[model samples]
Target: MSPLNALNWRYAVKQFANTTLHPQQLEPLLEAIRLSPGAFGLQPYRLLLISNPELRSNLLLHSMGQNKVTKASHLLVFAAVQQIDEAFVADHIECMTQQRGGTAEEYQGLEAHLNGYFRNMSDQEKVRWADQQVFLALGNCLTSAALLGIDSCPMTGFNPEGYDQVLGLAEQGLRSVATCALGERHAEDAAADLPKVRLPAQVLTRVLV
Candidate 1:
């Protein structure tokens, strides 16, 4: 199916059936997240995949009792890194050398440049930047899941503090920013019958020239 058609078929799935996505079905979705675009090629967030039923149950509590949190085959918690420092920037630049076959000498000033840029940002600013990057990745995951006929929902109605505590994020210098659940949609989903409502393209677009 074309990408537009796949997007048309997708919705914010609120409930799920008993079906689970196999690894083959889930891989592409994961890949899409891995390939999502980020600012300055810096993906300052991490994806925590939760499959344990017990952990999902705990997450459901923090998610305001959203059943899909536990009902879905897996819960993907998108967490933002707590801080960005010189060492972290250097490590990423070092990784670039391995991928692109360059010596660190060629990248000498890159890490410090990034460090200086980040140093200008407050702690809250850094977290906000990471959170924005997480959502970009979430968009990729959701689009890939839709194309693969997997149901999903991007959720923000949960408690971030509760998630941070339950997931022990502080130990890893990460904090939950957003979440998405993947699975098969329940048959009784009334939302499936409703037509998507949106403003027409004319009203939503503008031509500068």
Candidate 2:
């Protein structure tokens, strides 16, 4: 399907069917999220593709009674880094060197710039910035899932501290910012029949120039 058609057909699936995605369908969606853009390409987050039933059940407890947390075939947890420091900048610089076939010394200038930019932000600002990056990946997941004819429900109604504790995110210096449930929609899902409510294009967009 074309992107617009896929989007038109997609909705936040309220009920998932008892169907699992074939690896062929799931892989490409994962690739789209992996390739999602971020500030400075630091990708200050980790995407947790969870299929473990026990873990999902535990997460449901923290999800503010959202059954989709466990009802879906898979759960995607977007965990943002708790902090961005000199070490984080250094790691990105080394990755750039290894991937681009250059010496770390050659990227010292870039590294310094990144470090300086992040240093200006307060601790709270740093986490807020990371959370924004995670949302970019979440948007990619939703669009890719739709294009692949998979059902998805993106949510942020859960308790973050509970999720962080259950997922051991704090130990990893991460915190759950959002989640997307993925699967096939149930045939009886009334939401599928509802017309999408959106602002008209003219009202939602503009040309400044």
Candidate 3:
């Protein structure tokens, strides 16, 4: 099916069936998110794939009473890196050097640029910036799931601090920003039959030219 068709066929699944997505079905969606773009290519976030029933049960408590948190086959938490500093920028540059067959020193200019950019932002602004990167990954996950004939529900109606504690994110220098629940929609989900509500193209966007 075309991308447009896949998107039209997908929705924010409200009820998930008692079905687990096979590894084959789950990996590609993960790859799509792995390839998601981010500001400065820093990709200042981590994807937490949670499948442990016990952990999911713990997370459900922080999920605003959303059973989908536990019912979905897998829970993907997008966590922003709490630090986007010189050390982080240097690491990314070194990675680029290794991947592209160059010396880390050769990428010093690029590394300096990224470090300077982050240095100007206040701590709170840096946090917000990293959180924004997580959303880009979330969008990629949603689209990839739809294209792969999987159901997904992106959610933010949860407690972040609670998640950080339950997931031990703070010590890892990460903070939860958003989550996506992946699985098969329940057969009796009324939401599956509801029409999508969206604004017309003219209202939603405009041509600059």
Across residues 63-155, which tens digit of lDDT does each residue of candidate 2 receive? 999999899999989999877999988988888888898898899899989989998999989988998999998998899889888999999
Best-to-worst order by TM-score is 3, 2, 1
lDDT of 3 at 56: 96
- Candidate 1 stretches greater than 4 Å from native: none
TM-score of 3: 0.98
TM-score of each: 0.96, 0.97, 0.98
- The backbone clash count of each candidate, in order, is 0, 0, 0
lDDT for 159 in candidate 3 is 100
lDDT of 3 by residue, 90-182 (tens): 889888988898898788888888888888999999988888888888988888899999999999999999999999999999989999999
RMSD of each: 1.1, 1.0, 0.9
Model 1 lDDT per residue over 1-209, tens place: 57898899999987788888899988888888888999878988888988899988888889988989999888889998887888779879988999988899898787768888999999889878888899899998988888888889999999999999999998999989899998888899898778999999999998789
Ranking, lDDT, top scorer first? 2, 3, 1
Q: What is the lDDT of residue 12 in candidate 2?
A: 97
Global fold similarity of model 2 (TM-score) = 0.97
